[model samples]
Target: MPYDVEKPDEQWRAELSPSEYAVLRQAATEPAFTGEYTDTRTEGVYSCRACGAELFTSGTKFESHCGWPSFYDPKDTDAVELVEDRSHGMVRTEVRCARCGSHLGHVFEGEGYPTPTDQRYCINSISLRLQPTDG
Candidate 1:
């Protein structure tokens, strides 16, 4: 699928930090419990760090103690894209920013979460930038 914001490899590298580029572009996972938003409870929207596309919101975020920021749903149905990941000798659903195709994280389901959706969108903090809502 073609993305709304597409850029060359060099451009992406130049824009994102080393760690951000790894998770957002190379599909690498950050260390568990080490992300900036793992325990964030502020009211805001989380947008894709690479392209500023809104992906998840604070309303959908929950504490799963899984080390990464977890959300039961995205800000919108079309805000993200899921792909079948067969890497690391296992199968999982990988999530990406729909607008830029930057790797966000993985989504899991059927774990018995107490949210409207039983799904969990485990996203990398480096892949996101939080915009706090003002009163």
Candidate 2:
């Protein structure tokens, strides 16, 4: 799919760190419980690290103990784009930033989480840049 912010491969590599590039650009996963936002509770807006597009808000975040920062919903319906992932011998939904198409992570549904949507947007923290709300 086409994205609003399109950068060349070289530019993306230069802009993002090694880990960030691996996840955001190459669709790689970070180690469980190792992300900066994995256990964070600070109120903020989580934006795409690559394009600065607002993806999820702290209000939608929930503790799913899935090793990544999980959100029940995106900040807006158009904030993300979901694609079918059929890797690792399983079918799952992959979430990407709508603005840049950078891979954020995967979203799982029907697992009986207490969230209103029952959907867990298990996102990689390296894929996000949190902007804390003003006190």
Candidate 3:
């Protein structure tokens, strides 16, 4: 099927590669330490992989050791949406694109961090693109 940016299902497949689409749109998780942003220490903002919407920043990211990119808070409250995820026989808060409502990942609480926000935004690399700021 031809991918279309205007079409949710089609654009998702077209805009993202198979692996990116699977993890970003379908909420499928990549193997531990397999994500590109997992160990990223760059100084910049992280935008959506599917869309160029700013979500998190490098300052908000912390070493959660969860094999995924973890952030203490998001750059914007409306940049991402949250949904009730009931997959894998457990309830989780699913994160999505506020603009397109694309699945991003899950956020967890009590991650034991000392950021402005104590919450951990366990995001997927396929769901984000780090944009380094001016040096």
Q: For model 3, what is the alpha-carbon lDDT of residue 42?
A: 91
| Residue-by-residue lDDT tens digits, candidate 1, 24-61 | 99999999999999999999999999999999999999
Model 2 Cα lDDT, one tens digit per residue, 1-135: 788999999999999999999999999999999999999999999999999999999999999998999999999999999999999999999999999999999999999999999999999999999999999
Task: Supply candidate 2's per-residue lDDT for 81.
Answer: 97
> Candidate 1 — which pairs collide?
none
- Of candidate 3, the 10-residue stretch with the lowest lDDT total is 1-10
Candidate 2 or 3, higher TM-score? 2
| Residues 7-52 of candidate 3: C-alpha lDDT, one tens digit per residue | 5588668878999888877778878888888998999999887877
lDDT of each: 0.97, 0.96, 0.82
RMSD of every prediction: 0.5, 0.5, 3.6
Model 2: colliding residue pairs: none
List residue ranges in candidate 3 displaced over 4 A.
Answer: 1-6
- True-vs-predicted CA distance for residue 116, candidate 3, Å: 2.8
- For each candidate, how many residue pairs have backbone atoms clashing (under 3 Å)? 0, 0, 0
**Roughly what TM-score does model 2 have, to 2 decimal places?**
0.99
The global Cα lDDT (0 to 1) of model 1 is 0.97
Candidate 2 overall lDDT versus native: 0.96
